[model samples]
Target: MPNDHYEAEQSVISGPKGKVRADSIQFFKFDGKSEVDPQKLAKDLEQLRAAVRQVPDVDPDERDRAVAALLAAQDAATEGDEVKVRANLKRVGKWVLNVAESIGVGVAIAVLRQVVASG
Candidate 1:
């Protein structure tokens, strides 16, 4: 009798991560986060979606327009949207610094309160 208990799985080379295991790979995917694979076009679209989701009662037409604009921006990026990309990078850097500063201040306040309670 032939053994039928074991099945062999195959591997495929897809991206930089070579030899992708069949059981460990996903084909269709959508990450809701803004910064997925930074080089991926889908990441830009996801960022646009996240920004659109923030507005109160956003109109369908407006959302469509935004998506169109994002596509154009992606094209421009492909054609070297250097100025816009640099500006955005700078803005994000500043925003991150501000957030870190706020969190540091909050932590300092909590620590001071704890010290006061102890003393």
Candidate 2:
């Protein structure tokens, strides 16, 4: 019989001291204040979605991903999860920053910059 992986748990490391390497890292800080207005961000994202659709340079797949990221960020903002909001917005910025000007989402670009510039 083949042994199942993780049938028993082992090798647990609990502390701030370790090699600490990963392909990605998620940092969530709760500073006790909402950084963005969820309602306004939702409206901006809708505008952004319309703009992205009209952009000839953005492919279907990229458009889909960016839209999804923006929606996720909006949801995170509404839920008061700053880390998820910023992370998702960072994904949107990475996907569309180069074409943001062309897409005419200037306000959006600026907003995203404030959130993701530090990222």
In terms of lDDT, which candidate is strongest?
2
User: What are the per-residue Cα lDDT tens digits for candidate 1 across 84-111?
Assistant: 3323333222222233244443321222
Error of 1 at 106 (Å): 22
Pairs with backbone N, CA or C atoms under 3 Å apart (clashes), candidate 1: none
* Highest TM-score model number: 2
Q: Tens digit of lDDT per residue, candidate 2, span 45-86? A: 667766766667767787888878877876775676666766
Pairs in clash, predicted candidate 2: none
Clash totals for all models, in order?
Answer: 0, 0
Q: How far is candidate 1 from the true structure (C-alpha RMSD, Å)?
A: 19.0
Alpha carbon lDDT of each predicted model = 0.37, 0.61
